[model samples]
Target chain A: MSGQLTLYTYWRSSAAYRVRIGLALKGLEYASEPVHLVQDGGQQHAAAFAALNPQELVPVLRHGDQVLRQSLAILEYIDETWPKPALLPADAGGRARVRALAQAIACDVHPLNNLRVLQYLERELDVAAPAREAWVRHWIGSGLDAVEKLLAGDPGTGAFCHGDAPGLADCVLVPQLYNARRFGLDLAGWPVIARIDAACAALPAFAAAVPEAQPDGPRS
Target chain B: MSGQLTLYTYWRSSAAYRVRIGLALKGLEYASEPVHLVQDGGQQHAAAFAALNPQELVPVLRHGDQVLRQSLAILEYIDETWPKPALLPADAGGRARVRALAQAIACDVHPLNNLRVLQYLERELDVAAPAREAWVRHWIGSGLDAVEKLLAGDPGTGAFCHGDAPGLADCVLVPQLYNARRFGLDLAGWPVIARIDAACAALPAFAAAVPEAQPDGPRS
Candidate 1:
């Protein structure tokens, strides 16, 4: 937990935002080195960054010689190293529920609308800009709807994704909602997500980690 | 681990295949209550199944009162409860590496091409059958390409996703490859995955869990 944490991140990437919230929750300090996904023909594609992560993706957390790519993976490492504010639950069932919610977003929702996927839709599928936007909204909407069902239906869901205090699922959801709103996707259908996200944003960890508050946030 | 573990699964559902592999690895006995995903307008949509999983997805693992949804969640739960021949690595970094590889499949790849999304493409987007199949192949190809890059590029990858042992990453990769092969997507490009799948299938645990070998498999 004390090994000079360095996060290779993007200000606006939802996945990166998930890791930031996790670090703050665990009271871990890390230097944020931004990797602009779009700037200068994508810095992540550069040889320097590729050396750190062959996937050439951001939210690569480097602790000493160990480099962890994938935001969820980095978050898990942080949780294991610092177990004070546990990201997962105690019981196996509870942990499964929390992880299920996290994957509900991480797996089902975010990938369809990621910058790379969107770019692919345009370049490969020849989808029009407007249709591409619709595609984004479609996947996001269905994904969030499922999440809403998971959160709302389960009595286990408290103020956050699990038991009041923000945990792993909330770490994932808030950033996704940020992207959801940014894309102009209507969230009126997902009340549970709205309430949970509100609770998460109220927390300093989640608030400070918001993409709009980051160093690269739209320049005022 | 001793109780009746019922996996509500479809033979061809890769997500279910993941849990099947996990259960097999843990040497746990379970009932394969087939969910018939494509029959009678997707048996997963039946009122009875919907009550169990509101998400209307296959591969819900039922153990006593607890009904576990999501393949990764069930796999992790099985690992935690059993804790023998651990699916994840011993070290924090190693575990993160394995989980990341798994999520790279569970999160990034399979979700985009799952049953629901394909149904959506056909119904909502008016995509033709061939185009939908092409869509499946496209995502699978791109996703496997990314995964191949991750596994091959990482020096940590030994015989399995981590060291010489097959762990969580193999649990995810093997099933996804089943789906990929079922769809007739080319596997020649993904040597890392191809090699890993071969290793997994060689094991009794992974072998017993193959879709063709399942209770609900064709001719089963």
Candidate 2:
């Protein structure tokens, strides 16, 4: 936990945003190295970055010599290494529930709408902007609808996705909602998710991790 | 671990196959409730299954009162609930590497090529069969390309993805290779993955969990 931490990130990438929230929640300081997913036809495709992660994806965490890819994995590594303000719950069942919620967004929703996938839809598939918009809405809407039901139906849900704390699921959920609103989707359809988003936004960790606050964000 | 275990699964679902492999590795028994993802407009849409998992996704593991959704979460839950013959490595770095490899397939590849996405591409956007095939192959090929690099580049990769034992990454990787082959894509492009796939296929745990062996499978 004490080793030098550095994150290869993009300002608007939700995966990077997830890791930022995680680092903040654990009170871990890390240097930021932005890898623009858009400019210059994607910096992630550069030889240097590709050497760091053959996947050529951002949110790569370099904690000492262990270079990590995948936002969920990096978050888990941070939790296991630090073990304070746990990103996951203590019980196995609770941890499973938290992870399932996280995957609901990370796996089902965000992957469909991320920059690379959108680029493929546009550049290769020749999917028009309107249809592409529909594609994004379709996945996000259905994904959030399920997440709402998951949160609303379960009594375990409190102010956040699991319990009152903003943990792994919250770290993931807030970013997806950010993308949803960016696409001009209404949050009214997912009241539970909207409420959780509100709760998470109030937290300093979540607040500081917003896309707009990053070094390479538009406002900066 | 001793509690009654039930899995709501689809025969051809790579996600369900992952949990099946994990259960097999742990030497745990579970009752399979096959929910055919294709037949009858997908039985996963049924209210009975929806009540269990609003996500309407396969590989929902029910352990006593706790019903879990998401394949990776279920696999992790299985590992935590039963420590013997562990799926993840003992060290934090090793565990992160294994999980990252697993997510490279689960989150990056499978989500894009799953039945629902393919159906959406066809029904919503009216993407032609050839183009849809390209979409599938694009994600799968690139995903496996990354996996192959991760495996071949790392000295840690052995007979399996992480070590000599067939663990979590192996369970996820083999099913993905199966899907790639089903799409008529050649495995020769990814030698490391192909080698690992053959190694995994040699195990009874993996062999018994193949799509063809399931009760709902075609040969059944």
Candidate 3:
């Protein structure tokens, strides 16, 4: 909290949304620098932003001189440095469960349906719009189905993805559910996920972290 | 080290390979259960393996009754449970660096090129062989390019990704390098990655974890 904190983010990026939720959950304040992912061929690709993140991705958290990339890594850094409202569980097994759930979305679900991948489908692979949407829904459905199964069947799942309190897994799941709805995939079948999303949405942390609530969000 | 450790794995799975390296680095012994991903319509789809991992993926670690999925989470679990020869660095920033490097490969690179994704391109999208290879090479190339930049420009990189130790990043990088070679992408362009791979290969932990050395690896 002592250092000057800044977050390079896109309002609609699920990865960035995860970090936003993490920062909010930690009660940490930071300057928001919006990088439009689709404006004029992606502001993320601009020289300055690319220099900040070699991956040219958003949700890069800079604390004074320290710059951190990858949303999950950033979440962990926040948890480790701040050490309040722990994002992960105390026990190793529970920590593994939370991280596994988080990765299920972050690594498996989110990456496949990312802007860059969707753009590649359209531009490079010649995937038509309908087919592209189908592709997005397909991965999101399969991935969410797995997540639903994991959450629904596990006794560890409480008010959130892990236990009573929302944590890292919730940070990842809420944003993914947002993307899932954006792509028109119904969450009726994923009762557990829907319930967790509802629970997380009730919190101010998750509420403020939604893409629509961001500074760069569509002014409706 | 005392309790029975069981790993459900696939020979050529980069994710599974990562777990193997992690176990080897910790000098932990585990019984290997091979889940044939391609043979007999993928044993990973079998009910038993599905029960172990709802995602139906390989490298599920079972210790006693605790079952873990997702290779990265498993790596952290191993690191936390057995702190000897830490997979992550000690400092918070250093740990973030290692995790970011690991996720660059795990989340950004590998997930897009996984078996299910390629299968989707072929079965759902009807993308042909040359185009599929192009897709694979495209992602691997772009992903590794970012990795090369991260490693090459960072002063934190020593003999390995963090310092003079082979940790989580090396576990991820070696497996990814193996996958890149399998897809016929030349590694000559990435001097930093190649150098780190060479440094890691010289160690018994990594040497023993190579895909070709596994019990279920292709013979001859």
lDDT of each: 0.84, 0.93, 0.92
lDDT of 1 by residue, A1-220 (tens): 4578888889999999999999999888888899999989899889989777766677899898788878878887888889988998888999999988887788878888888778876776676898878888887787787788778888898988899777899989988888888879767778888888788877899888988788866777
DockQ for all candidate structures vs. native: 0.66, 0.93, 0.92
Cα shift from native, residue A209, model 1 (Å): 0.7
> lDDT, candidate 2, residue B218?
90
* Winner of 1 and 2 under lDDT: 2
Candidate 2 residue-wise lDDT, B133-220, digit = tens: 9999999999998999999999889988998998999989989999999999999988888889999998899988999999888973
* Model 1 ranges with Cα > 4 A deviation: B126-134
Clash pairs detected, candidate 2 = none
lDDT, candidate 2, A53-162, per-residue tens: 99999889999888999999999999999999989999999999999999999999999998889899999989999989989999999999999999999998999999
Q: After superposition, how far is residue A64 of candidate 1 from its true place, in Å?
A: 1.4
Candidate 3 residue pairs that clash: none
Q: Show model 3 residue runs off by greater than 4 Å.
A: none
Q: Report the lDDT tens digits of candidate 3 across residue range B47-66.
A: 98888798998889998889
For candidate 1 chain A, the 10 contiguous residues with the lowest summed lDDT are A118-127
* Top DockQ hit: 2
Clashing pairs in 1: none
Scored against the true structure, residue A210 in model 2 reaches a CA lDDT of 90
Could you tally the backbone clashes for each prediction? Answer: 0, 0, 0
